[model samples]
Target: MSMLGTKWKLHGNGKTIRPGHVVAPEERLAWPLTIGIGMQHVVAMFGATFLVPIITGMPPATTLLFSGIGTLLFLVITKGRVPSYLGSSFAFIAPILASQQQFGVPGALGGVVLAGVVLALVGAVVQKFGAEWINRTMPPIVTGAIVALIGLNLAPAAKANFDKAPVTALATLVTIILVSVLFRGILGRLSILAGVVVGYFTAMARGEVDYSKMDAASWIGLPHFQTPEFHLGVVGLFVPVVLVLVAENVGHVKSVAAMTGRNLDDVSGRALMADGVATVLAGFGGGSGTTTYAENIGVMAATKVYSTAAYWVAGIFAILLSFSPKFGELIATVPAGVLGGAATMLYGMIGVLGVKIWVQNKVNFSNPINLTTAAVALIIGIADYTWTIGELKFTGIALGSAAALVVYHGMKGLARWRGTVAEPETETAGLPPAVKSAMNSAAKRSGKKP
Candidate 1:
């Protein structure tokens, strides 16, 4: 393989591939087919990537530009061993809003840069040592608490947007639900995007969309760019995001490894470092923080093509698209109602994912440490608790994340002191109906047996 693995031989004469066979990362189809797949990658990533900037009041073109750049950077840093596309991270939504209030967008960017540096450092540590310590530090219970709380805390914001145009939001949500059920495979996976499109049309019908801002944008021009400013105050808002990024990257590596039937544990650290660097680049260049996008993963899963060559084409396409300010402006025209509709499902899904993590890991609620850790954190997060010191402040997500870690560790240590820890029960019958419902709902959405 070459340095960036840009050299790829033909995969089966660049024609139809047999079932149960896939084009490896180092192999690609003929020029036209590969280009088509690459464009498909762009469409797959379009909705979720643009939503981050639209929601956070950042320039959509700028974010797209960095995403393209980040994907290329990831390929280079990982030495093309891993196949992934970088996109804006949803974990930054709440924190960016919080930091923007006090320190503005630049301040939020500062936090992003710092978080990337921290993640990169963790990656270096993992590369030198191993990833076992990460599991020890953030066990399933603790990680679940943090992830769930972050989502639950955003409920109020979702409601606020939903209130802006309740009818439109409702229609959007309904469309999303229907689309997921009506279509199978790739379309079902893209329910969010489908819903957004339906909602946009709904908003238009309601005469709520404003088209004036888009007229000024040119077809060919540079995207709006801004510089990050240092802000020690918002550091707390973004550091927890590094953990989420770590989980996402690790999961990406694991997923690719599973599909490719390759041992990717060796490059896990490099994967993390690559995403960290991508995020750092985004922060400095006025874009949302980047992460390995599941949307792209979904695309690869459907096509059974794990070609890095396709991703290279996708990156170039994204860069070219970013140069068109008119497209960026068009994206920005999405109404709050549509965003609210998407967020309602998206945020809840994030929370449920945490619960899924618990279920998958068989995290024992019967255990006091696990129960207390989750209970306290959920309340603090759902209630939107706040704590302020002389100059530092902690809101729901920050406070909840900290509480989960401290409570889990404190109770575990005390249990050890008293020798009270015991085996966890694996019975699903003991779970609450709400939990079971949520889990089943999630299972259906992911196309797995519930």
Candidate 2:
């Protein structure tokens, strides 16, 4: 079998490819079509990638450069089998910001590096035992709840962005929905990019866009890179984020598996390891922590293109664009409302994906154990509930994830203990003698032996 080429045979007119057919990782379309699809992935990732730097006070260009570098690295580590894009991780935002205030940017970088190391260690454990252990520890109910929690946790940020400019945000959201629902093939797949472009022009027409940044930006420039300074205290502060990263990566892999109809359990460890290494590399270069991007996953879902080659092309394009200050400025000029609108859709889909996982797995919600686990996880994650132990903190997705595991397992163990001694069959014992005799007689008559 070929590792990296078209697996499907063309029939009739080879020029026309059918809709809903996944273009596999090893496959390639004509260069022009492939490049356009790659560009769509870049556009899908742009908002979140730059937003991290804007929030954390890191240079946007550096973040973009590292995002590209990290994605390429991830592709290499996963053997180009996984179709994922590495983007700035919002999971590390709170911890990184807190570390920055306490220690400096270098210190925050140190913390990020440490977090990466922790994730790498976890990846090692995953590789050794395989994903089955993780699945058992975090079953569909728990994983589904945790995944849904990620989306619910980000709802406020999406809303805040929308509130900044409601009109443009609504327009962007509506345009995306219309294009996705009404259009077919590539046009439908490019809905996110189309929405952003439409919303951007709409914002510009309304004089909401600031042109000064773009005008002042030089056509060519290099990203400002910073070196990390290791501090034990700061490093310790960010380690908890590893949990969130693991949960996110696992969910991302599962989602992609469902989309691609491929079994990715074998590559789960490699994917996590890649993400960890990428995060460490990004931290070394003064970039935000990186994670598998759900935004791009949404694009893949819409486009039906799971080609790893497209991600490689997108990464190269991002790297090239990162050297252009003009390009960075142009991306920056995307209105907050437009970004928010896109985020709303992307995040909501991620949440729905968790629901999809539960549905696919046939999680029995009627079981009190399953219901309780999901309930507690959702409430804690959605509420942004937090806990502190000494200098370590657990909150939002991290806390929700931990809670789901502990609650589900604890309830299961308790239930097992309570039922250790199986009760005798009680149906006959509780039935009236006449009815029982009648049932026995009917059984004997039907079977000759009861």
Candidate 3:
């Protein structure tokens, strides 16, 4: 059992454990372990976390500062039920770039704040209907398709970076793979961190890194905070950014639930609210929007530790780190090629995780709607196609996801109206004996009957 799973113990004999009777441990995380695990969370999110500012032309330090503030606020709003480790959200990168080109930096932040509002609204909707509705409305087909779309949609942008900086990118990639595949124990766990370290040093030796500001910087100071100013000109751009971020928030919450062996219902709404509140706070702190990071979940799962306090420690350290201009400069100088190389595996893992989710959920595909929905979603999302309707231009995973939702549910609604699509037994019949056994075992472990 994972640490969190172990903490949630069934009081009676395991065979007859009743729902709502499980006991939670007094502490989800221990001390030294907490700081260490928190560091792991920090390292996991470092790469993509700073990318938002780099792309949007905001200071990297501002990104770090906001991420820390946002993360702390998210924890408070969620009543500390979720971890707080603020970082950059990739979902907002493209939109921030678009908004910047269209309306400048302030306009971009305005959009980001609006995106935060959209997330909060989504949370409100989820709260009203309840999480089971989200599951029922999403189903495996819809969520799975969206998950797949998430990675597929980003592939082209990654490839463009790779093409622009092949050698540096390859070095970063090789280092990441080396650490992941060749290293062991703590080293293995920190493969991405180690790879970035090695790649950064390598770049520095080649004069690719510029760290002249290290000597001119103060060791400690308060971060420069900027307030957000909104305008109507960029509302459209910001709204979509927020919608896409909401989709990402859904995925992140689901991932954490899977990691903790809890139902998605346990934390989805609270987590969404946390991310939304974090973004609002981040705006006040003069930083970018924040979201839950799946990487930290991976660390928690591996360490079997789930301590909000540990995340608090990590959050404090992040805030401290954010105040140093020299530190931000160092983080900024990391070779983009190295980032691209590391991203190849990182992004690919995200795609694979989507497939794993579908497998875990035992999504039925025999039905025409199920197969068609997943298939079309993967194609359109991965291929990066878009269409505009009136003032809205929908494309990428956002478009693919919207399309899948429409096709699957709309067809089902139509069937109810005209009697066509029906649930079929064979939709789930293809799983081999081994997979069924594994899934059944998982269900048992999770205290659920198959």
Candidate 4:
């Protein structure tokens, strides 16, 4: 068969491939290939998607159901132009736990709803003014610091779980690292799922697995949905989380744009609005706030398939699986230690990705303005710093993000006031030559001059 007739094509080191030959996001493959690829995405996202609900004591089935619903909603909002999977967000885990403690699950859901509203409002601003204003305000330094803070801020949670079952957690973490580092292609892409499976088996061997729930679970059932109760006090506690979500969504969109060699800045507002609406919908259903999954992005990077159609298939699959109580119970059987191991790796990767962003943007650390911004943001975020006034509280990732924006922009203003010619930001300088060449090629293909 000719290359064009084949269902799959390889773009290895020596192969000469044209940009036009690539499978773009809007294109579709045959059903069999699409289903298989979609399933791979499902596996890629499964570990982290379920982990958030598990951590926050939310119903896994409900979370799974809403994830599908949210992704579908997002696709519709973006007019199916963007390929993404919406999953429960880890950024809200701390806030959810705290809100639940103070105001019960319904009240927590209320706070989540309000946070979504806040995100939507921010999205409106992005839509009206364009993403450039946001870019100017946050920039690489601020966004990177906030991203790193997200990962670092979650370290204690991972440690707490690890402390419960050290051996199992360590085994899980090791297995993930080995798979990710040593394997190639799909296996490496699915490292987190592999780690979870290995860890679960390890836990089983250690007699840590509990089959009681799985055995008792029904074969099929609807998720138990809950109604949110609005509380003014709890809203203040959780509204700040929108800052982290904004930073996260912006980064994810930019990463996807880079990977696809397409400029998606045009839809930045729509993406944020979709995610915000998804979060609101999920909150109404007793699920965590949802965001685009980076795990799926890694899968796309590995497989070289960026089809939006595959995401539709994946969403449908998730929707079907969500009705299976047995599946939810099975996921619950995985020991906490196993989760800890995976979370540790995932969270650390998130932090490193922040640094990667800085490197990719060629953020100048030598500049006192950039240096001070990043320094203060990291410290505030990592330390979970907070300030309270009356019933309002600014803290955690929110505080860190605020600090980053204020510090960076403040420095920029001061510099301009002093009549100093700020250094022009340069393209990535430290990246490998081959990678840079590829980026240039992608830029050219996308009709952007490199």
Candidate 5:
């Protein structure tokens, strides 16, 4: 038999069976092993699990419960094709908080739920128009700007937390830095976890840690599932926020595909669908919008483990933890100072990622229009404290993102009209094998063989 068709023989003439068939090496992991590594992903994303609730004024335990259930639903919807753990995204924090303060929690939740639906709509668009269309509409420059806005908008929250107890926050920050700098192996990989642990102990030593809540917590029971209430005013407030989540979902799809060496369709179409749908489910279950967790990507990158099944394991763990009031209390008890120090790193990383995207895309700086678009966008995004348009008010990072998208696209359009920038070419459609063969034959006949 040819090598291509051959199977290995073992035990003195019999071929031994190969382990994996169609699945990626990592994808074929057993349930136990998958769960083991999956738990690591959960741990990595734990901080952000309840952060959405805290920021948006929803109950923290309810958020945690839905996060777990939403993740599992996401996996089921995706048919377990992608190995991503879903969690509350930081991108919505600014808008949700603003909406909550302006409208109320129900209104914010409505917006978040609407955001999930928007993501689902984006997925349909991706299916119909194809990835190239998405690539064209929201190029690297646009995404970078949005990502920059996401981080910059979050600056106030981090600063507010840090200012509450600068000394304690600094101590936590020091611990995080020390672990990141000095640790190795699992210790280094879990530097965030270690920092939280160390900071918790340090605060305890200083008699600053509060354990009063732990005593009030029950030993076991399900989360308080909430029924959503509808309001037009709340829904309207969240509409823009939903639009932003759609952009974030696109980024998540891109990030997973880049990290996993898979095409977006090949990697996780169903998964993306699940991410959106599960988020809707989460909202109904009294939670916020869910997206693929970026922190878990860090764990996978470090361990070089890419098993989709591992996320299922993490999902199960999350579900169990959700029902445990003590677990909820523990997660809730993490000091804001600890969160602040980490946020300094986490939020800044978002900005740095934006810079990376901008630099790598080689954004056309030579063109005055390009320069103006980028400069204005950055200025508006980073320092947007006020704007009023004939009565309607707009400010902060959302304004910045909206401005960047409009300005960049408008400039590009103007440049096209003036014949300064060439018109964009349509991406080539798929070519079947027979068509390829026919084209090749015609080319050979014309002495232009390829």
Candidate 6:
């Protein structure tokens, strides 16, 4: 029961996952199946993680290595209570570039390190103060909108992939749907991974999978690395990103809580500090700042498996893979079309998970404050609004999350000042122990530990 403990008791039967049952963070499945799901998560986070470094003109290998390291670090810090994958954050891109001109790449990385320290400090505050105030400020409606907008904000990224090879994208998307419907047990749970396999081969047939890099890549090599050089000027450019990262981490906690029907609010601070620590490590060795990846969260939503053990596998495997250029190149061969199809499904799932938060919490949209909060925030996020002040940039998720809080509190406060009826909020119940009943049944039948 240790919050930071690594042990994951086996889930029911460790083979078949019955309907209405999800694998919890502290539980695990058979090694083979867990390994597959873990690999699926790696594939899920790969594209976006590498893109940050690639776009910022930093070495992609360095980012991958740190991200993998960060993922494992996050799992440990959260004490296995929360399941998440740490990946390169898009929020860092603009600021890192801005800092690059003034402070150079090393200094930009230093800013990342400092930002992580600030984030960790924020986590420490939440840890000391408790996270209830976070909930007070952001109720179900606001949190739900925050999660929904993050997913919707990536719609264009999905569409861009869809456009690359419509036929291939459709095939991949269709396969994901059909596999879930046609199969049960492990295959059903692995539908996304299955779709990826089918799509890869399908793309190969269409001459979309490029094998050139795979052939040229070496079997083993070290990912490029560099140390940070501190610069105070870079702070202005990067620290603002902490706001977006906080919103994302909080949204992730809420989403997981909603999906698992459990109250994960307790781990909010630890999750934040974990990312901060992970990012600090990334900065030390020239990697992109990390955040909990929505892409991997989408995979969990699809799989119904939230085992932190799988993340351990994914993280360790990523570290191993970072040294292999051939493997990196091979993943790159996965065409935009395959990614497009996956993005379409994964991103949309995340958006809906936000709405699910509303449904589960019974957020009364009939209240004008609630309705407007969702309305304004969703539009800002889905439209991918962008605003810049000096060297700082704020984009969809950051803006949308901020918008939800402002719109909700602003309207609610104004109504209260006017002595208007402030609508009452529905309470969120503690999530049922989703795996508990099944575990009891299996243990009773087998005379084993529950």
Q: Which parts of model 2 have CA positions greater than 4 angstroms off?
A: 1-41, 47-58, 89-112, 226-265, 293-310, 420-450
Over 1-450, each residue of candidate 2 has an lDDT whose tens digit, in order, gives 134322423322333357757766656566676788889898888766776676567878888999999998888888877899999887676567656876789988988888888888888888778867766676788777876777676778778889999999988989989998998855676677678778888898888899798899899998778999886556434664676678789889989999888888888898899999999998999888999988889888876777777888899999998899887777767778887787778668657867877887767675567788889988887787876666555666667777888998887676555643122111244579887677556533442112
Clashing pairs in 6: 3-79, 4-79, 261-431
Worst 10 residues of 1 by lDDT: 441-450
- Kindly give the stretch of ten consecutive residues in candidate 3 with the minimal lDDT sum: 20-29
Model 5, span 330-373: residue lDDT tens: 66676777677767766777777777766766664544555666
Looking at model 2, residue 13 earns an lDDT score of 39
Residue range 299-366, candidate 4, lDDT tens digits: 78876777777888898999999999898988878888997898899788878877987887888675
What digit string (tens of lDDT, one per residue) describes model 1 on residues 1-450? 799888887888788777889999989998899999999999989888988999999999999999999999999888888999999999989898999999999998988888889888989888889899998888888888888888878898889999999999998899989998999878888888999999999999999899887998788999898889987777678888888888888878899999988888888898889888988888998999989988899899999999999999999999999999999999999999999999999889889988988998888686667899999998998897888776677888888888998998887777656655553423357779887667555533442223
| Tens-digit per-residue lDDT, 14-72, candidate 6 | 99888889998888899999999999888878756765665466777778889999999
Q: What is the lDDT for 45 in model 2? A: 85
lDDT of 3: 0.65
From the highest TM-score down, the ranking of the candidates is 1, 4, 5, 3, 2, 6
RMSD of 1: 6.4
- Per-residue error for 289 in candidate 3, Å, reads 2.5
TM-score of each: 0.93, 0.75, 0.77, 0.85, 0.80, 0.70
Of 2 and 3, the candidate ranking higher by TM-score? 3
Q: Name the better of 2 and 6 by lDDT.
A: 6
Give lDDT for model 5. 0.64
- Of the two candidates 2 and 5, the one with more favorable TM-score, higher being better, is 5
Candidate 6 residue 174 Cα shift, in angstroms, is: 1.2
